[model samples]
Target: MSTTTHETRIDVDPDVPLVRITREFDAPPAKVFRAHTDPELVARWLGPRGLEMSIDHYDCRTGGSYRYVHRRGDEEYGFHGSFHEVRPDELIVQTFTFEGEPDGVALEKLVLEDLGDGRTRLTSTSLVDSFAARDAFVASGMEVGVREGYERLDEVLAQG
Candidate 1:
């Protein structure tokens, strides 16, 4: 049996160029971590609803890089990044770049903490170069995409 929850908490620090997101899943750490690192599972639940996602290449490991695109109708959004570190079922550190603003790159770190009883808590922090860049990312409707994507992930988890 599995469960579903939609309690994603997002915080943007005013004093620093950072964004933090915390969410809980009704699954173990390894399962959630695999969902994040596996390209096939990532394509199933890593973006907003109604967008077709295509992965150019996704190598999730230390020193590995990934590039993917999401398309809705004629519009296409591309993102690429490199994995700086990977700790199975525990942590991932990576660089994130949106193709639209090539210069506004962010370093992201995600940590998964097991809550016991088949649940995991995911804490994600993104640090950008400037407050303006962080604000821009916050203003880009990222919350919607994030929340919906996690909701979809919850559903996917429920299936297992």
Candidate 2:
């Protein structure tokens, strides 16, 4: 078994208005792609560590809608998004809105690549309307949450 801590690549534009994060998983591309579209799988591993998720609705096809709520103790965060494009095993594009800050919505593009060595690399790019908004999100400790979330995903994949 290959025991390697996957490094997350996050890029923020100092002049532009976008944030990008790339991560690699030990699982195959098919499995990784399924995790994103499958409601059961996503609800199991798609939040910050210790946050429980409740899926209100999930339709992963093109032009479909997805809504979910994440609960952390007494606080709950809701997110709703619309899928712009959904190409199986390849790419997905969507518009995301956070109920916490409705004005902080973004367009997200996620691409999955099969690395051929029993690994899959997922690259997620999020474009906000302003640089300040992008910066604020990056400063919000989302990186740590992302790391923990992926670690949870690794555990989920390992279960089977």
Best by TM-score: 1
Question: All candidates' lDDT scores?
Answer: 0.94, 0.88
lDDT of 1 by residue, 34-153 (tens): 999999999999989999999999999999999999999999999999999999999999999999999989999999999999999999999999998999999999999999999989
List candidate 2 segments past 4 Å from native: 1-4
Backbone clashes under 3 angstroms, per model: 0, 0
Model 2, 1-160: lDDT tens per residue?
A: 3345688889996777999989998888888888889999999888688889999999999989999999989999999999999999889999988888898889999999999988999999999999888988889888887888787788776665
Deviation from truth (RMSD, Å), model 2: 1.6
Given candidate 2, what's the lDDT at residue 134? Answer: 91
**What overall lDDT, based on C-alpha atoms, would model 1 receive against the true structure?**
0.94
Models 1 onward score TM values of 0.97, 0.94
TM-score of 1: 0.97
